[model samples]
Target: MKSKGNLWRVSTTVSQVAQPLPEDKSVDLVVIGGGFTGNSAALEAARRGASVAVLEARTVGHGGSGRNVGLVNAGLWIPPQEVIGIMGNAAGHKLMAALAEGPSRVWRIIEDAGIDCEATRNGTLHLAHSAAGVRNLQERHRQGAAMGWPVECLDAKETARRTGSLAFYGSLFDPRAGTIQPLSYARGLAAAAHEAGARLHDQTKVTRIRQLGDKWIIEANGFTVRARALLLATNAYFDGIEMGFRPEFVAVSYFQFATAPMPARLRESILPGGEGCWDTAVVMSSFRIDEAGRMIVGAVGDLDGPGRPIHAAWARRALSRVYPQLADLPFEHDWCGRIAMTADHIPKIVALGPNAYASFGYSGRGISPGTVFGTQAAIALLEADESVLPVAPVRTHRERLVRAKEVYYESGAVLTHALRPALF
Candidate 1:
């Protein structure tokens, strides 16, 4: 997975690209990967007066950070109790409590650093695609409310008014969550890090990282960075550093298509509140309106794979099915990015070696979780403490039947999308 420019970079007008990594140098921290997590770690560490250097295989936001759905959501996809079910009581509670404020952290950074990436704080919707979906939302609402989250369940009428679509039976709305220009946010974080004395390098991939005594020797871009700590925040786009347990997870592809900005009348009536949305289905789908008024819809399956046509046609039909008023609106931009999905659908923080860690497997929730993990991972490394991390650093993380699971995911998405119209 080398650097591939995405729709975010093409459409965004943010100015935060960094030069390549230095030929050779020594720093307190070396962050491998310029996505949300790595950049946040660098920014956090550097702001605290630590000398930091961040290296990216491509330009800033070139990875999943640039290609994500841009949903700045709080918490994980599941409820707090389900989080407990996965990671046990104490650890799960700690992780959930920390991530519960993830969106707030992002908004605070955006405000403090003045990063203009279309920061919308209105809210986000978890729509129910069917009666079963509504029941799922009800359970989620119960769990969320019990955990003190101000989650609201909107009925069919409110859902229709908020989304300007009648496709969903209901929706679970979270006021703490919102949307952003993901690529711009990534670039903004890099710029803020650089301004805070962190050295950021683009197009410089770390080929190898080995410990020399207590310090780390990170080799990349025909140079080496000798640092006391290192953070691997590559997420779903690990190009190099092919050593150790590199966060085993299925690389599920998610594609999005952005339509041309709608006319004012249509825009006013469609998704009038500027809330990001995703439906609750086995093979999930998401849609949002950007600051420029363009509608971006996304779902599983690769846009460049054998299921390309199936996925593309599914997108067109799904968009029409959801928003009949905007049917036949041609999509202007179509792209795909990989998601690092663990078997448990939870993120992992793997302790690579002494003073080194790699955080990945964000599932599809990158923006907030990436920030939390990256920041905590860096703090843990700098402070020599694993207690600060959301997930206790694990020595190793593994995935089974990866290739088979990848096929299962794609085939399942294609099958679901192919049959969705009739099923609905």
Candidate 2:
């Protein structure tokens, strides 16, 4: 069934006016893409007394930032040891430590800015879908504990009690992570950035960018913006604009369906502690309860494509298997968004030019990483200090066979949803 619309768009309490580009302007920084990254950078740069302007093609949070699962998880999808193996000790540790603070940074911003996004810090659960998944969680818990993180390994009975379902072998709980109304958080960032002296223009798509001496010139909405630094934060929803450099990653689609608010009794029994959750299956799924008591379930695959019916049917069966009490509940909202999945699942910071950077490839861990990267990118760019950056900036990054990889991912998701047992 076609979705009524994005639940976040309809339910988001935070609002910001999308003003057009006022006129040709000069600033210390020009940010393209007003999602979490761009807006966070804008807010940071402006707070540091830099002249900043953000140009967004659509309204703030119109991209994956608005349509995500809203899981404010810490670290990347890969475990910390894998990250250290790939990036080596120093750089890997730097990135992990920075991202480990992701949830707190998000909460701090919400508190300081008085932005109400239904902010919750109760933590998140990483469910084990099978015995192999259990081992994976055990390894994750070991790695996190070695890093001095407060990660706990829960038994099957405790997992069932916490999640209100007996669908898993065990679970890993991270007290640092949480959930939020993602769209509202994006809009709140935009609003806070605007209040902190950053100029933000929505419906302003940048078409061209060029460097003149030490300044970067941006053309958008028939206006010219010359700045000393630039940040391309479009991620998976990058519009077709030639900014001399393109961020590359395999774009994978993820869709979600939300049921209407359940009764208080039902809501109290399911996820009563307000934890967000996702399983360890290869084609994983996430489920969480919103502030209004609505249960949202999401997985890989395009909900608007030919596999829509298959995915929609799978959603019902999957939810029923876990929470049989909600089997007859009808989904009232559905939406889909793309994730910029990197080969190694590590985010990249590309040095576009002198004092300029473009960050992408969060690999489905956008909220915390985006916030950390955006804030660090701004500080590193404005202060001319590469050491301030979480990850060392590279000259260029290229992903081969992006389209084919996208197809492979979507097809795998569709095939799994069609053939996998409901008990899984």
Segments in model 1 whose C-alpha atoms lie over 4 Å from true places? 1-5, 422-424
lDDT of 2 at 35: 91
Q: Model 1 compared with the native: what TM-score?
A: 0.97
Clash numbers, per candidate: 0, 0
Estimate the lDDT of model 2: 0.92
After superposing candidate 2 on the true structure, give the runs of residues whose Cα lies further than 4 Å from its correct spot.
none
Q: For residues 131-241, what per-residue lDDT tens digits would candidate 2 score against the true structure?
A: 999999999999999998999999999998998898989999999999999999999999999889999999998999988999999999999999999999999998777
User: How would you encode candidate 1's per-residue C-alpha lDDT over 1-424 as one tens digit per residue?
Assistant: 2223356877777796589875799899999899999999999999889999998888888888998999999998777898899899999989888888999999999999999899999999999989999999999999999888999999999999999987889999999999999999999999999999999999887888888899999888789899999888888888657465466889999999888788898999998989999888888889999988888989988887888888878888888888776677778888899999998888998888999998999899999999989888878988998999999888888899999999999999888877767222
Clash-forming residue pairs, model 1: none
